[model samples]
Target: MTSKPAIGIFLSIALAASALWFWQTQTVRPAPAVSFKTIKGNSLELASLKGRPVIVSFWATDCPGCIEEIPHLISLHQQYKSSGLAIIAVSMYYDPPNHVLAIADSKQLPYEVALDPSGTLAQAFGNVQLTPTTFLIDKSGHIILQKVGVFELSDMQQRIEQL
Candidate 1:
């Protein structure tokens, strides 16, 4: 049989861990104001990107679904940038500033990315359950589209053009 002290210690540890997870999960976070800095120190503000339609992709490095959709996102970012579209990839995992930059560099991605390793920003946008959740915002900053499953970037572009 276990000693009483041992059982108490185990319970304490479990409760502490549970509380930490709860705190992390339950807290609310609001969307940031127009701009915020990327982990790498580049100035990033939603307001500065206002003239263009915005695409915010919530992804994680290790998620297969997220990785699979990256090329599509890249295509969207490239094709629409000139048309006043801005794509901001908000990574959910392995989100050090350097990690975000490395992916951008390797892919030769021209748009911007911001990290939210702890899900603060993700929560702000009401995107918490899955990776690769994408939001397409109109130039006026309204969330015009949202995709939770795998989707084609071209299809999104076609829809935007129609808007």
Candidate 2:
């Protein structure tokens, strides 16, 4: 009957939708193995930070969104640093080291701020071409979230806590 055929089609659509949702939710990538040299003259190897949640943010000093997210990033570092959460804010290659250092000092940022003058850091992180791009890697070194522009603080906090 027509009613039976309609019901079958609806079930098929529902099943396909569920499959797509499952696939999307499970798509997580491993973080790239990269090293960072912070403005404070410290070296950090991404592989060494395994078993800890890490936030690798690519930003520029001139980006308004990046500037706007600074406070939130600072808050997160303060809240979670004691709990094995590491945050590295890498300035874009085009941003001069002096400018990055000036901004970091002016803001009194408590976390690591690195300069990417050669763009190797950006290239390691998916060839990052945009400012205010952030990747949240879990304790297992798998990137669970990649967001461009400003991210929701609550959502990021929740994810970090979950990790």
Candidate 3:
């Protein structure tokens, strides 16, 4: 019973609504403001790295998956540092700071290594309850991706290249 003009108006409204919904859902969000102290007593702040892409990794010393990702992260850091990529590996609260420090030293980790003794960093990042959870924040501070486990090197590289 609707006239042609009325049908066109309805369709236009629906299309506009759909486009708004898509934009709201697809837009990346800014990373949470969190800070941590590196094992060597250096301060690292998420907000401070706004102009560079950052990879924030939550890990524990005893986690097998976490251990598995270290080399890949190190390699990624080495490969992307010149391209303005910063990686911060934050040890979980359950991990003793000394252990984290020793491992960082032994492995000669070139990137910043931090200790989350109170788990504040993890809690801020959506109560991250799993080891190996990683957030890839783009140069503008928006969270480009979040991975719950080991990050595939190739996939991560492709994502980074896009940023």
Candidate 4:
């Protein structure tokens, strides 16, 4: 049988290994190199927004959660746009272009809205197939936070403020 001290040493090693793994997984990674074609026919590149905080949100018009988050995103944009925050709402390729345009128009969205017709953008961003997947990128173009669903508004605001 293993002695008590031996077991304790093993447990300590396991805990240290787990902590190291967590730290490596949580390390921030650089954002994907991608460009967006806005609904308004303007072209923008992610690299060009290097010196500002950016939110790249992948969403679909038919997604309930995506629709639910629009107001909050609009509020964030309005609150931070003047402070050098950039937000881009990217509609999934599966979403019809007409629907995307209608929603953007009806909501009077103040941020950039782009369409992913070929689905290349989704594939580039870590094969993002789920709706409402949001990435908060810091000024250096590193992805600081990635959320698969609706994010906590307070936490998001705090992170953005700190960036």
Best-performing candidate as measured by TM-score? 4
Ranking by TM-score: 4, 2, 3, 1
Clashes of 3: 0
Q: What is the C-alpha local distance difference test score of each model?
A: 0.70, 0.90, 0.87, 0.90
Candidate that beats the other on TM-score, 2 or 4, i.e. the better one = 4
Off by over 4 Å in 2: 1-27
TM-score of each: 0.70, 0.83, 0.82, 0.84
Q: lDDT tens string, model 4, 1-163?
A: 5699899999999999887656433548999999999999999999999999999999999899999999889989989999999999999998999999999999999999999999999998888888898988999999888787876678789989998
The alpha-carbon RMSD values of the candidates against the true structure, listed in the order shown, are: 9.9, 5.4, 8.1, 5.1
Q: Which ten residues in a row have the lowest lDDT in candidate 4?
A: 18-27
User: Candidate 2: minimum summed lDDT over ten consecutive residues — where?
Assistant: 19-28
Model 1 global lDDT (CA atoms, 0 to 1): 0.70
Put down candidate 3 lDDT per residue, 47-154, tens digits, no spaces: 999999999899988899988999999999999999999999999989988889888988889999998888888998878888898888999999867777798899
User: For candidate 2, what is the total of clashing residue pairs?
Assistant: 0
RMSD (CA, Å), candidate 1 to true, equals 9.9
Candidate 1's error at 52, in angstroms?
A: 1.5
